[model samples]
Target: MAFNYRRIIVKIGSNVITQANGLPDLQRLEKLVDQIAAIKKSGTEVILVSSGAVASGRSLITVSDKNDSVATRQLLASIGQVKLINTYSHLFEQFSILCSQVLVTKEDFRDRLHYLNMKNCLEILLQHQVVPVINENDVVSVTELMFTDNDELAGLIASMLNAQALIILTNVNGIYNGDTKLPGSAIIKEVTAAGIDFSSFVSTGRSQFGRGGMITKSTIAQKTAKLGIAVHIANGTADNILLDVLAGNVTHTRFVPNKKASGKKKWIAHSENAATGAVQVNEGAKLVLTSTKASSLLPVGVVAILAEFKKGDIVKIIDERNKLIGLGLAEYSSDKAREWAGQKNQRPLVHYDYLYLQG
Candidate 1:
């Protein structure tokens, strides 16, 4: 069968990789590894963002009552990461496919330099025909710096690499119109730029073993798709889920891609969290920026500089009510931007090429 995408990100959620008792499900992992190996042999580059370290860690050690939740997690992640990566390494070894373990925290992508460095490292691994098995460095990531879940990390990786698609394997078949347990609730097969409000039907409940829920997946999927990467959410436990997704033989929710976005824009799309500065723009600027016509953020349209940042830092654009408008790379220091705010004919604070508007 012909594969649809030459490059893809596969994110396996904790719920899909762990058993009911919160232990690593080795049998299920082996099956998924077999499928990934087959996909790699078919000439497609695969980057895996997997979750199961905590579950794997839980199996190896029991925490004392004196340890708090954070301490417990750190201990588990420190120990479990080794077990999880080793399982992946051993499984891929059977097929003569080499895999590398990549652990990262939100801090890794906080700045442009760090982001590019990580990207370069992954590129080298792929060039050497090594599958990169990535996971969050839970041992070091505090609650404030943690990604919403592996789904968010996967989206970032997909956008960073300009992947053709992102396939998120969860416990559920796909996003549904109502509670999944209800008999009549149907899966929403495809999502486009139609501005559908998923919150009306999708539940906000977290997964049994994961931090995020369907809401987080849908949000990240939409953002990733807007950056020109198609996204698929499907059941990881299904037979040959990865292969079926690539072959168009699976039932899942797909977020259609825009396909016209530039690589820089894709990177900017995910930089909202990495932004260090904030600027509130006038309504006039917001309207033009969000319009079909491309426009740069001019100093004349800026109302206030809300934070201090260097010229090259990523900044958040807000509206009169302090609502986020988008994220962009600043062309000047916040001090300079403030001096020129509402002034005429100043250099654009953020050029259209580096700006990513939000909905």
Candidate 2:
């Protein structure tokens, strides 16, 4: 099939690879891997964000009350990660394709420097034709230190890599407008910035082995699409679903790309959840930050500082009314910002290269 997107991010959810027995579904996994290989042979570059380690580990290790705890969950992820990646490596070998395992934590993307470094690493892999099979480092992840789910991770990667589209493979065919079992219910094929409110049909409940659900998927889809990348949520079990969707022969929920964003804006927008503090700017400051076209948030514009953050941390830029207007890396500590607030002769709070305004 002639797919439109040359570079794609494909997310394989835990439910897609987990069986009713709480173990990895080898047959299903093998089939999905085959489809990925087929797509790659068709001249498409693919990055796989896979989740199933914790589910697979449960079958190998006995579970108890303690197993439900965060520490135990991390142990399970560590144990199954090896087996999961090995299985993927073996399958891809049959197609003569090489793949590498990449494990990461939310901390890696929290810093702009590390974020760019990661992009460099992935770009090098793609240049050499090696597929990057990535998974969250659940071994050390807990609470806010974790991603909402792999869908959120995939969206971040899609935007970071400047991929044309992201394909989220889940158990469901797509997002439906009503009860899926009902005769009239159907998949909503497309959504955009001006789309209807589909949240009414979304269920907050997550999958048995995953942390996110339809709501999270839809939300991430819209967010990534707004940064000028398309997103598709489709059933992984369907025959050649990946190929079909790319060929425009499938019925999947598609989030069409909005106006394109500069590479820097995409980074800032996706970094919303990573904010470490806030800088309260006055009317003059807000205008200076947003209208300068390319200028730093001068210390003279700061009216207040909220929360404690060290230099080089991501901070939200708010107005005097406490409305969030932008985000950027603070060059000064919160204490420094407090000391320099309303002072015209002080250094800039945040440089222009690191600032991103909200729409």
Candidate 3:
């Protein structure tokens, strides 16, 4: 494949930007900015999803007064987010690049309207030739996160903004096929199949100074690939890594996207965090929903109500076998839905306008 990416989302994790001292590493940050500047000079629109605010904040305060607690983390993030963005702004400005800081919470994309608005804001920034450096609003969002990680955010932004590629920069070389400690272990160069499982080779451990692991990056890569966007998971420390990956001269894990899925289908099927409830349907309904020219889900096909949800909530539409067929905003409450289950006639459970089948 040729490097024809026009718009790209680059995710820089905490470890990639922060040193072991829990502070922003200038050398690494400078190299990264230089690469991104080079990419911008090539006429590519770039969005950065960064994750070093809290880690940088950790070292800002005294080590003797450390709690390593969530509350303290929130406080540190409040302090460090400013510093992190300021540093990014200065570096980008040196290269004549305009940068803007945007703090987002997972709540921003909880609904269709909200998500579209967020999309519009990003579109405006890109149109005006400003690079938006986004980070999760860690201080404000406590109960629910706006993104699972920067990896997930990058995937969402790549898909949401109709980006051509997503490059996730992490500490590792890429997804390894065997024990990362062993000598013979190798990186999986490419993943092309839909629903290709990589859990067996993944570890549950998270990275230091970062919330997500390699497995999390891999999962995000797979989900974004379904939307016809290429995903690259590569080592951030490697020299000219970004340029090399674009040139296809580097050893990195690449996810080749399927070109069949539409934009709406991608927004639904890959919305792992935005969904709210579950609605189980029988065999007849499952077949119809997955078939070509799918009609609205009628009341007669619903087999069970697995969760209590209100109308307009994005619920998971599952088959009797517990296979997820699609996601749709509910038109009825859980009580009304259960009462109308298997009935001959009723309003469409989920209208065609909102229903999105799995890719």
User: How much lDDT does each candidate structure score?
Assistant: 0.92, 0.87, 0.84
TM match of model 3 to true structure? 0.92
| lDDT by residue (tens digit), candidate 1, 1-359 | 33478899999999999999989999999999999999999889999999999999999998897989988999999999999999999999999999999999988888778889999999999999999999999999999999999999999999999899999999999999999888999999889977478899899998899999999999999998888899999999998998898888988899988756876777788877789999999999999999999899999999988988898899999999989989999999999999999999999999999998887
* Model 2 stretches with alpha carbons more than 4 Å out: 1-3, 65-68, 181-183, 282-301, 320-323, 331-336, 339-353
Model number with the top TM-score: 1
- How well does model 1 score by local distance difference test? 0.92
Give the top-scoring candidate (lDDT). 1
Ranking by TM-score: 1, 3, 2
Residue 88, candidate 1: how far off, in angstroms? 0.6
Q: Give the per-residue lDDT digits (tens) of candidate 2, residues 290-335.
A: 7837778998888778888899888999897888898888887999
- Candidate 3 residue pairs in clash (backbone atoms < 3 Å): 105-146, 106-146
Global CA lDDT computed for model 3 = 0.84
Q: Where in model 1 is the C-alpha error above 4 Å?
A: 1-3
Q: List the residue pairs that clash in candidate 2.
A: none
The Cα error of candidate 1 at residue 243, in Å, is 1.1
The estimated TM-scores of all candidates read: 0.98, 0.89, 0.92
